[model samples]
Target: MTIESVLSNNRIIAATQLKDIKRADESQCCAMILMNGKLSELMHMPMVHKPLFIHMDLLKGLKNDKEGIAFLKEFINPTGIVTTKGNLIEAAKKEGLLTIQRIFLIDTNSLKTAIQNIKDYRPDAIEVMPGIAPKIVKALKQELDIPIILAGLITTKEDVLHAFEAGAEAVSLSNQLLWNGTTEAITTK
Candidate 1:
């Protein structure tokens, strides 16, 4: 499918499994995939076909973070740094990385703390958990200019379709399932 296709078109983005990432990413069937961790294993794959999205904690925990971030800047910046710190959001902006601040799983106080981070750090998108609630999606869309991407328990084509219909611009693939880049979920004949 073309990149311009609607978020539907069964827009499948395969999640990288910890050990299987290399094989899964290299699998010819999967045309659209996102990966976390090191890229050395994926060198054989064409860069245009392989898009990478990384967890913030993994990036931050790198032994040589400066070098790692420098290398990452070349291909797919962190989708967003999942940080309780919120300060890292500012750093991401300064370093010119698109960010998604993962909250919702944290406590009420941390969630409250994250609101100001949105104001100050100004991420490109903010994600909510366990699927997007229309009310919450509306509030976040109105409160911030950034788009929303929903995470967790978002399975099946209906769930994915309902999410964007509800106001989320995108919904992350359930970690338990990766599309393997095939058009099986694409709903194309």
Candidate 2:
């Protein structure tokens, strides 16, 4: 499925360990984001039916550079990549892989820098961390046209609801409990 379809259809994406990949695949989550993995682990990663995205910054033994992205495209071959670097996003775009720019909003300066970088690079999507802030999500939605994926520090069902209410296109979390059955329950509500 296309990235847009994955994001539009699945409100909750499972960000899980490599060992939990199968669980994520079986869960209701429409996509999987592998956060902590080694280059070797990814090289031997089990096949996942859903869209798989690897956090490039978290991968061990892989440089967050164009060469690393090229290697992933040629071998690991995930549906997309999550990274904090704009140059890598450009490189991933060149390799025809979907890109999600992960931005950590620590303060006003950081947020402004993130916004500027996003506008300059223009990845397919943006993932805002410490995603419990509905007000920030609302502001970001007003600032950018790209799809926003809220992640990090999302601990409750209410957090998910608030994120959607703030105009987030999707919410990604590592909670296995939520991954199993949250979409139908919350979306239907």
Q: lDDT: which candidate is best?
A: 2
In terms of lDDT, the poorest run of 10 residues in model 2 is 180-189
Q: How does each model score on lDDT? A: 0.52, 0.87
For each candidate in turn, the TM-score is 0.63, 0.95
TM-score of 2: 0.95
User: How many steric overlaps are in each model, in order?
Assistant: 4, 0
Query: On residues 20-111, what C-alpha lDDT tens digit does candidate 2 reach at each position?
Result: 99999999887889998899878888788989999998999999999999999999888899999999999999999999999999899999
Q: Write the per-residue lDDT of candidate 1 for residues 79-176, one digit (tens) a residue.
A: 33443336665665566655566657345575566577778766666667756344467656666776666676766666666666677766666344
- Flag regions of model 1 displaced more than 4 Å: 1-12, 18-48, 59-68, 71-85, 105-111, 132-134, 175-189
Q: Point to the candidate with the largest TM-score.
A: 2
